[model samples]
Target: MAGHYVIAGKKIPNHILSMGFIGAYAGAYALYALKPKPAQPATPPIQASSSDEEAFIKEFLAKAEAEESK
Candidate 1:
């Protein structure tokens, strides 16, 4: 009664409890290892056109001029 576990007025054997714990541990690891990984989308490398670069440079210069006039 001191070290034994009683469930519903019945005593559970030590071997059964140890097996249940081992089974649960194995099951948890199995699920973790077998879980599906998320698919990552492949991204294309960005190539900036000359027109896009010119537009960006113009915008950046406009912002700098506005900040300087403030």
Candidate 2:
């Protein structure tokens, strides 16, 4: 049924070729299936003090501005 397209003047259907390819690949690996494994977040050794750092930065900026105004 298949001949050189240049000579046979016929184009093969995409679905037919795709199904044949899928069948070939699936038959080659019929017993096994592939699945993506879930990723786990790394555990941190220490927690950050967000509020404390924010307050310290604000207080430091205020002190710096007060000193500059003098």
Candidate 3:
């Protein structure tokens, strides 16, 4: 006698159960392969500053010295 599946006390044929399993796997794989990817974020453009770097450093140091003296 060949082996069979007993689901919910009902006898299911092996070939039918195998086909159902294969069909489910195929359908899941199809859905996974056809799914759309998320969109990539756009990066902002860099701008060149027109301000003087030396003046900025000097101003920062002056503020730090003033705060330390208090």
Q: How close is candidate 3 to the true structure, as a TM-score?
A: 0.51
Which candidate model has the greater TM-score, 1 or 2? 1
- Return the lDDT, model 3, position 58: 62
Alpha-carbon RMSD, candidate 1: 10.9
lDDT winner? 1
Q: Which ranges in model 3 have alpha carbons more than 4 Å from their true place?
A: 40-70
Superposed model 1: Cα runs more than 4 Å off: 1-3, 42-70
TM-score of 2: 0.31
Q: Model 3 misses residue 46 by how many Å?
A: 8.1
Please give, for residues 1-70, the per-residue lDDT of candidate 3 as tens digits.
5678999999988988999999999999999999998987664433336457656766777799899999
Question: Each prediction's TM-score against the native?
Answer: 0.52, 0.31, 0.51
Ranking by TM-score: 1, 3, 2
Clashing pairs in 2: none
Worst 10 residues of 2 by lDDT: 1-10
| Count of steric clashes across candidates, in order | 0, 0, 0
Answer with 1 or 3, whichever has the higher lDDT. 1
Name the weakest run of 10 consecutive residues (lDDT summed) in model 1: 39-48
Best-first order by lDDT: 1, 3, 2
Q: What is the Å distance of residue 39 in model 2 from its true position?
A: 43
Cα-based lDDT for every prediction: 0.82, 0.69, 0.81
